[model samples]
Target: MRNGFKIISFFIDPGAIQPFVQNAGFQSGLLQTIVDDRWSETNRDVYAFWPRLSTLYNLNNNQPSTWWLRNGSFLRLKQVDLGYTLPNLKKVAIKSSRLYFSATNLFVISKFKMWDVEMGGNGLGYPVQSIYSLGLQVNL
Candidate 1:
């Protein structure tokens, strides 16, 4: 965060991007999503790793390559937990008790690029959220 303004980056450059597809790389179970003849047009190759592969293109061959923006992010706080179980109170009419115990989304952690504040998967402008809980319980 810079001056309270979130810093984000994107890819927006289109140039000759050609990756030759192995003619013999055909698989039996899963088909490759991307393949090239090594002599295709020019554009920045986008590898979002999700949904599908994307690329920018010009309407005419004489025009320059088009570009788009892609962003990968870093880890953000997912959850926090702090709790305390009540002491032995079963001697009287009361039974088990608890205090100041809370739990949030403490399982999923974001695994994206270096500027992502999202959890789990990388989305757009997903600010990392923190869950704070307070409560009291008693069993009788």
Candidate 2:
């Protein structure tokens, strides 16, 4: 694995006709290989497997979609949930009431991409942004 900023190669040739070493690979996840002063971008996800999940959402893949999930690149904000309801209902033969909040794909993991590749729509492939929910229960 390449450490620090300098290049770590297999000692074949640094300025030869073929810059790529024959059997050079990474050692572990702790080290990274930086090539040509450029880092590997989120390519795996942008080019992930587009399969048939359903008729509307992850169906044929080329169809119109509301969201797209990038694969094998980096960490991405993935769900969100928030809820609230009336209280003290369960005590009297009624459903209980409570309040809660949550978020999915809450924020983004990478700053390189402003928008997520997994997300797509007929529009311009906007992002999932944030989702919020509210609910209520009553005793009858």
Candidate 3:
């Protein structure tokens, strides 16, 4: 018999390197078209030029640029599980049992906004969700 009390066990899975396309941030291609009501043309500077809506609407003659690509790299916390095993319940006809709580897709720290970073195509997809669960396991 292993003469020791099983205290705590933890499992963590940090998922893969996900490269995605994000378009909701300030680095969007339609920056001038999506500004808020407080936006002003006078706010334009030498470095940040605000294009008129008509100018942007007539941009079929312009060439595409890579200036609107938001960095979509992040380390995601995929899942975390914490569990505790109870001592053997010999009299109850139960050998051992464990209770555990787990969570998935908990959080993401990214520069992108209003969208999930795992879609990876043109940034048009459903967002990811966080899930939580609790369970028990027994060995008889």
Clashes of each: 5, 11, 0
To one decimal, what is the Cα RMSD in angstroms of model 1 from the true structure?
Answer: 14.7
lDDT per residue for candidate 1 within 1-140, as digits (tens), equals 33222222222222322222221122211234224412233533443222222344424322322222233333323444444566678678787766653444433332322222232222233545546577777789
- In TM-score terms, candidate 1 sits at 0.32
lDDT of each: 0.36, 0.35, 0.54
Q: Give the higher-TM-score candidate: 2 or 3.
A: 3
- The candidates, ranked best first by lDDT, are 3, 1, 2
Give the root-mean-square deviation of each candidate in angstroms.
14.7, 22.0, 5.9
Q: Write one digit per residue (lDDT tens) for candidate 2, span 1-140.
A: 12211221121111211112111112111112222222124333432323222225433444444323322134544454445454456557775554555545555444223234344222244446666544443445
Stronger candidate by lDDT (2 vs 3): 3
Residues 23-135 of candidate 3 have per-residue lDDT tens digits of 33334454543453122465654333223323344452133444334455565677777677777799999988877788887777765553566655554555677889888
> Residue 111: error of model 3 in Å?
1.2
Q: Top TM-score: which candidate number?
A: 3
**Ranking according to TM-score, highest score first:** 3, 1, 2
